[model samples]
Target: MRLRSRLRGEFPRGWCHSAQWWITGIRDLTLNTTAAVATVVFVGEAKRALRHRDEPRTLARLSGTFEGYVASLLVNSGGLAVLVTMAIEEGLPVVLTALLAGWYLPNIAISATVFVVVARSRTRQPAAWAELDFVDQHAPKYGRPPETIEEYRAQQLRE
Candidate 1:
């Protein structure tokens, strides 16, 4: 009939005290943990994309950017409802910690897929650093046809 009596038997007598202390620590950390993790992942991905933008595989960088954005958006948004449900079933302190961890953890995984694809492409791509320089030479100079694209390809292929 009494909640306290029922909870006492259902859980150990000292569980409430320990859980309360743990929840207090969780509450202190919830928002900070979420923001720090999400920020680190986003910034790291952005940095990688920027640093590798000049890589031969243009499509890889483009797709990585798009995929990371969409995945993080979907996971974080979808996890909001789960967070709310958890808050109701559990408590905010506990649920928020779990929510932050579970939500962004998968985001890292999803982004890794993009990174791996790009990395593999890098490994397979032929070493041709002058590809862009060849394209640059095509710019008309003083009304003269600077060079043909086929000629540029032939040059790089010869190297």
Candidate 2:
């Protein structure tokens, strides 16, 4: 019957047709917004670390990794919830495949972006550290390495 087909997600179920709207909307509200906020904050902190020339890049990288994991977990779980809801409404065999794919694919792509940023930052940074060390050694008037940035600043002031 048409009812069975629609219930099983075999055909298009527009807005208000099935629980699809509710499920997707819920995830958008709960998981997506939170992920976006966390991503922004993490990125800002990473930029701050770079600006300050701090060695806490490792912490920033790990935090980025955690953010990616949280995003993946929430997106996949929300997608699965929607899929299960659809399957329950209709039938498992006919659950809309596009909905299933749509749910997690974007999150996977976003996670990959997070991964690439972390990796590239690590690669670019190691070389930059040598430059930092070089400056630390040569730019100090006495040709001595300062133990900390604060010490370096004090030496520069005296010079």
Candidate 3:
């Protein structure tokens, strides 16, 4: 009699469990994808800064965008907290929860450290607003900003 009743249920024999797994999986996937994109942008900006480290005013322009990166990292941390909470509340496997924490926790820490370095650099280099004004006047079209501030200044000099 028990077996017969189980078979007749709306979500027979673990189907409901499968549905919960899928929902959590989708949420995890979305969060990870967003984190990956933000990481790429942050890394790209770092590389650009390195490539022009010797040039005047480059740090200023780069610092202009680091705040955005820090903001996104904080938002990612909040999302991670919600994910961890969901995993615990929904009885998710321990390994999966551990993996998520292990992956993102250090990421948040390291990324914040990098932002701190960038912030310090901004303080040491204080010509950011002047470069910004240069950008405003020279790249007013917004479609064809120079690849680097050095390059833009050189182009402006030539013109």
Winner by TM-score: 3
Selected candidate, larger TM-score, 1 vs 3:
3
Off by over 4 Å in 3: 1-68, 87-91, 132-138, 142-159
* Regions of candidate 1 where Cα sits further than 4 Å from its true position: 1-58, 61-92, 128-159
lDDT of 2 by residue, 70-104 (tens): 56656665776777787778676753666665645
Clashes found in each candidate (C-alpha, N, C closer than 3 A): 0, 3, 0
Per lDDT, the best of the predicted structures is: 3
Worst 10-residue lDDT window, candidate 2: 5-14
Ranking by lDDT: 3, 2, 1
Candidate 3, 1-159: lDDT as tens digits: 256432333233455556654675566565445444355444555566666654445644553245455755776688688878889789878888888777666657645655666666556665764555454444412123354465467457535
Summarize candidate 1's per-residue lDDT along 3-74 as a digit string, tens digits: 853343334345546665457446546533443335344455545665664465453424224434544545
TM-score of 1: 0.30
Please report, in order, the local distance difference test score of every candidate based on alpha carbons. 0.49, 0.50, 0.55
Q: Spell out the clash pairs found in candidate 2.
A: 7-90, 8-90, 8-91
**lDDT of model 3, residue 39:** 52
